[model samples]
Target: MTFQSSSKPQAFAPLSAESMAGGVYGWLTPYLIALAKQNAHIHSRLLHLTRTELHFIALCLALMGEKRDDADHFGAFARDYDRLPRRSLLANYIDTAGPGYSPKLATLVSKLAGRPWRMRSYLRLGELYAEPHARKTLCHLASISRWHLIALSRLPAPYRTYGVLRKIRKRYDLACVMFGIEVVRRVRTDMTDRQIIASLERSDTSRIRDWVEAHYERLPFPTAPTGALTDGTGAVSRPVATARDLFRAAREFDNCVDRYLWEALTGRSCFYRCDNGQRRIAVAELKRLPGVGWAVDEIRGPNNAELSGPERAQVFAMFREAGVLPAPQALSRFSWFDLE
Candidate 1:
């Protein structure tokens, strides 16, 4: 499970538990903050977790799941996390989202938090609510497919925020439904590469819509996500005006859907117990290059911690080579946010 370059094994900086947690938080915090600010009421109401704690929980869950049963180094982190107040906080949210908010969910969360989570269901549930699109996507999932797909298709691309990307993913979900595939089946588990590729094919949209409308009932309310981007009417903005921006958007969009196309296409979905799904998604974004094969292997290997600086630099270099990431000098010219 060690990473090897073509000629030899590459040396990597060792990862400590705290540093790993910090790495994940840094990557996710800004996105969560932006999302919280965009939907002020939703951020203030309904959810009680802060963006930092939410992000930390997700990273911890992903890490725990990825390293489960390995009696090695990661076991220590898992043991340490079990004792944290944060563990119960995550459990509380899950209980709230369960079959009912009270005793049912309360009972469920209590039972679940009493031990380490085994399956990704609870984790997935938490993640679904963490993104900006959680509400809209859940509504689409529970509603008529025909109207939802049509509306989503009408939305513009080069998606600038989580809201826009959610729309695109809804259309994708509809397309899968049109092919006689159920929304839950396409996600929430290990899927084969064949199933993944087949998703690209066209299907009978009208027939699928009819079936969905008849079979599924609309949900009671929008399932608000744990995080989101700004409401888009802000002076501070992140625009996808360049190839780098688009590539990054695509990565984030794939992330929003979680364990669908990116997982399957990259072969990460096939190894549910052993896989840390995000690595493959990141590697898949790397441009075709001389050293990329090795890079991908390194990313997919054990250790399963955050990418080291050299590894990140290598990935970025590939993007630069592919013309998706601009040079450092080029990035300084843009004003991403206003002072006001």
Candidate 2:
């Protein structure tokens, strides 16, 4: 669509409701005035603009702002703006800004305008434009829904890295990405890139409980050879030798023991189910500290509730007789919720 110049002068006329119907044109007046000062022809061109042409002009202003350095080039573009087609205008406007200009913004704006205009997405584009990796990130923004764009833009600054963007681009599953964000943000921040990707890939359900259960399937079974830590008087403690066993223990005891699968697989810690004559009593974690040979890190009853006085005394006495020392203040009670 081409905008034609009219003989009747409506220059400096008040903006009507029809001219600013979608609210997208509200921010363009200030920018247009700023640009008209640099080029006198822009002031005359605004006199005969239709609403459609006004939308196009708003898009152009959004793409190439009224920067002081590019006044000459911007004036040249403004002089010929009425004759250019919609596609040509977008292409030429981005081209005039050189290689650093991200085409993603234009793509997103065009898509937003195709239907009803989304003011939130337009505002979010402005916020994202200031980021260092905005060029790379905007490439993916063109394909996502407006709601997804808003959700992604609201993520924590640390989670807005290129790697995370690549993950979002590849999967295009905002729910899975959100689940991964929660795990890394609240559960474990030290998770590696590969680990985070794996977690995201394994997510099949959006529910937190189901997601945590599915995560257990990715952990490898304990491979290092270790014996059971047992005591006399029918109170025996046996090492959880497999991932399945740990999962089962977590389900039966209603605790988060499965989160320690990484530590167990790496041989840094070992979990044992303490039982008395085939009846489970408590769960224990034995951590191997650098200088301390073997220390009883934690011993908790079902649901992570504390054991009774006698039960605690019995467990401690068993560890003492078995040459296992009590964990020091610095090393005791390691929780997966603690940041690495």
Candidate 3:
């Protein structure tokens, strides 16, 4: 089933309620009816939908099952259909008619819509859907979180095969649930996926977390541009340059700064330690926005607590002095962390 269109097709007439109620397009009726309750002019919008958009909605409705009642899902699909994965992949997955409304489907759709770079791997998964044990393989894939998917995307291509994914599902559940996502992420290096799985299976599980943490803490921090700042009143901020520093900071501040190593490593954002002379205070995260340049994304105290008003004011002043103050609307804008 070819999903690509070589030529511009004639405009399709607006679909009527009756035609959609029972026929080839009948699967879409439930979605249209549910969305119509929220949008009175849904039928009019349907007139503007391309064939691929219609099919995409149907596939989403089918996979989402009862969750299809949410109009925002449909709205997102309609607005970003062109940016979605190849129509062929969608059609092929729909043909499989696998499980419905699994966490995997949600993660898959979210990644497909929000992270276009991951589309190639998903497309590869779509190609594998026709093989034997596809349903089980898909179930395994769906069971893991988006973090695992991100980690999987970074692996060598050969390791992304169905066999490795099965191993990942099992190890991801055991290791991640036990050691947490940060440790799993920290341990993910070149040729480490299979080795980690093997070690977990063969070695004593009790020492794995310590080993992982030690392995992470011993690695030298990668060199990157820093955004360090100081207020000259014993107040200062320094960038977190290594996984070791992040791990130690997480332990000392009683926060999850370690979870953000991927962000820091990828240079999408930077984490900094805020201090007042010898007394540690807070952790500040900064990101470079399109128009805003470098802006403070968040500043949190110990235990991920929000800074007090006075303390926050001081931090903001320091950032302002450094010329990297966050815009009033910056927090409201989309962030890469939203994927988590």
Candidate 4:
């Protein structure tokens, strides 16, 4: 194809609606504006990342796409991490952002090292951010920047607008949050699962408040051993405030154990990195949650340290005979539908 400065503007093939279940021009158009501002090297670097790396980048794009810049919801999503959409909607968007269809994912990520994003570009970014792959990997180096918008938005101050209000200087709109489904999560660091779960199981649970406050992770006893509180990272138990809190603890414990095992055995978590840091775990990990009493990992692997060689075979056989592990009656006592 040949072009001249005077040539009439062109329209690429219209974004396919099926391919666009993730949102089309709403995502790509803004990215083009972002791409225009980048220097070549950075752009090329992002363009050259691996397929997995490319998916991570697109996750960022989908995330940053929903930012609210208009006077109404300006800066509202700041610090808002848990607002992921339903699993089905996000899967659709991933299909949209995934490489087989949207070739621009690489291009957009390559520019991350160079460009600054505008708020409007985020409308679709919100939907993409809700995508599960994006949610699962939100802790990746590529994914982390999108979350850092809380700190970055601090720059374009006055940070004021219509509909939304700034809180402690963060863009916080009451209206958007009224219907916002974002699930605000707690960020826990360090401390391994055996460490966390052991802590929880050992602690006193007489007081409901105190019971929830126990630490479940047990920090790998340092091979050389650090006297660091014997709690590994010095994070002792703290009070759990909601059902989500217990659930989060259970989830993290499961993830830490599974991830540690996977790395020791397979060198990776299901599809992402074992240490991908948000360190999100599968729900099955909740089975042996000490007090929780469910056994989800009925899938069984060759080497489970918690279980010896013979024990592994036995437990898995039992798991197969039992089929899927069931959540405890106590777990049912709490409504997952409502955290309160």
The model with the greatest TM-score is 2
Ranking by TM-score: 2, 3, 1, 4
Ranking by lDDT: 2, 3, 1, 4
Query: For model 2, how does the per-residue alpha-carbon lDDT over 63-156 read when each residue is reduced to its tens digit?
Result: 5544312655565556556577656666676445433444444444443433323334444555565465553555555454455455557655
Q: Which pairs clash (backbone N, Cα, C closer than 3 Å) in model 1?
A: 35-228, 35-229, 129-225, 129-226, 130-226
Q: State the lDDT of candidate 4 residue by residue for 1-340, as single tens digits.
A: 1112222222223234454433233334333323322323224453444534333334544543333112212112211112433232233333453333232333334324323343333323343334433322222334434433343232222111111111222334322322221111121245443343333334443332233222222222112111111123222212222334334444544433332332212211111111113422112231233443334322221222233344334333333343424333212433332211
Model 4 scores worst on lDDT over the 10 consecutive residues at 221-230
* C-alpha RMSD in Å of predicted model 4 compared with the true structure: 22.9
Q: Where is model 4 more than 4 Å wrong at Cα?
A: 1-176, 180-307, 325-340
Report how far residue 48 has shifted in candidate 3, in Å.
Answer: 70
Error of model 1, residue 177, in angstroms: 5.8
Looking at candidate 1, the ten consecutive residues that score lowest on lDDT are: 219-228
By how many angstroms RMSD does model 2 differ from the true structure? 10.0
* Candidate 3 regions with alpha-carbon error over 4 angstroms: 1-227, 327-340
Write the residue-wise lDDT of candidate 1 on 1-340 in tens digits: 1211232212222344544433233433333333333334323531456434453544343434434323342333333443546545344333343332121211223222222222344444334334334424434342322333243333222111233323235445544443433442344135453342233233234444433232222211112111111222221112122223333433544432222233323333211111123433232221112332211212221223344555445444443343443233212323232211
What is the TM-score of each predicted model, taking all chains together? 0.18, 0.47, 0.37, 0.17
CA lDDT of each prediction against the hidden true structure: 0.32, 0.59, 0.53, 0.30
Per-residue lDDT value at 76 in model 1:
38
Model 4 has an lDDT value of: 0.30
